[model samples]
Target: MKRILVVGVTGSGKSTLARALSNRLGLTYHEMDALYFDGPGWSVNSELVDDVSRLTAGSGWIIDSLGSPEVRDLLWDRADTVIWLDYPKRVVMPRVLRRSVRRTVTREVLFGGNRETWTGWLSREHPAWWSWSQHGTRRREVAHRTRDPRFAPLDTLRFGHPRDTEAWLSSL
Candidate 1:
């Protein structure tokens, strides 16, 4: 599990797990969002491909999020293992809602120094609604993608519940 990819819908704990796994395994942790969003604005990072390419050239790394399709193609082919946080919407929505509220209320700056606004939730672009709207479709898409023959060489560890992920982390 040297080169690991942690993937999930927003707020599904991919970043948390990726950080933990990187710490436990002593691998370089690369938060993809940091590479995808790098300033005080919403523009996509143009250096994303170069950043990912540089990381993949190394022998070990653990990254969070399935990046843009271009990056995903490059990442998935090189990653040795993929940890999928497949928690259900029932379990995920509240967590996302709480996180969204906390980040908004606290004005926590995220990737690109972006802060969530309560009024922002009125749109589907908000993390809460994005997670809510994308959860099912994201689940199906990732599941099907991983099943392809091209990805057969990649190891997959999927967690449907928090406890399952906790146990796996503990085991590691």
Candidate 2:
């Protein structure tokens, strides 16, 4: 509950949980999307590593994104607990699809001045695509990491359903 790393497939409620965790624990909230995506005409910054390093260097904070292994390791190495939102694909897919549609239709500004577009939603590079493709693999990856001796010392909280996740967070 001190310093947490909230990981999940897109639309699995990572941001929401991170926000609530921040408020409940009185910690800082760091949205990784904002750090990774640059303003207007969305582009990945070369300085993303430096920014992520700076953000995770603090003592008390919650990160809502899972970056590269090197960057993620840096955060997890320092974090006291790791919360993985492992909701079922059927539960997550619809949420992601609806969210994508809403963002595309409304042209909502996110992560700087960047907005999600309908074309991007159709593209394989979109978060929705990543979510769909990585659903099973990501869970295996997290499971392996949790089982590895290197990560064994890290506290792990995994939720197979959103309601269970809510209950766990409520108890925190």
Candidate 3:
């Protein structure tokens, strides 16, 4: 599908799946975090909306998020297909924990040239903490949006587990 959005709770592999889909479908791939986070210190891009709007105006692309608050509606409105990774907290928590730990241990650079630090894990904004705290909320939000009339024209592919998603991907 063209103009795709990959949505899920943090660490649900949205980026991974979106990348694979983009490659397989030959569509341009856009990482939402890379678009929103500009430089070091996790600084935000002031032109996020404009940038997102310009990208979405194109005829084909795949983005790895529902978009930040300011551009969420625009993303949903323009998207033709939405792939929702709806794994349970049991599946997601360990993933997020391992990912954050690896990033911290390896000093892996991320969006905005930021790296996860041990001290940063203490904050509620940390990926592990955010994923654990917002898991249910994210699921509910995606669920509601999938059924919302405003996005009725959208086609949704919701996977409840990793294996299911993998099998579907392999098929494609």
Best by lDDT: 3
Worst 10 residues of 1 by lDDT: 37-46
Give per-residue CA lDDT, model 3, range 1-172, as digits (tens): 8999999999999999999998899999999999999998899999999999999999999999977899999999999999999999999989999999999999999998899999999999998899989888888899999999999799999999999999999999
lDDT of every predicted structure (CA atoms) = 0.87, 0.82, 0.94
* lDDT, candidate 3, at 25: 99
Residue pairs with clashing backbones, model 3:
none
TM-score of 3: 0.98
- Which regions in candidate 3 have their CA more than 4 angstroms from the true location? none
Per-residue alpha-carbon lDDT of candidate 1 for residues 54-124, written as tens digits (9 for 90 to 100): 98889999999776787987888898898999999888888888998999899999889888887788987
Q: 1-114, model 2: which lDDT tens digit per residue?
A: 677888888889999999998988899998888877777677776788788788778878998855566477777677778899988889999999899889989988888698
lDDT for position 35 in model 1: 86
Off by over 4 Å in 1: none
Can you give the lDDT of residue 39 in candidate 3? 95
| lDDT-based ranking | 3, 1, 2
lDDT of 1 at 116: 83
Q: What lDDT would candidate 1 get against the real structure?
A: 0.87
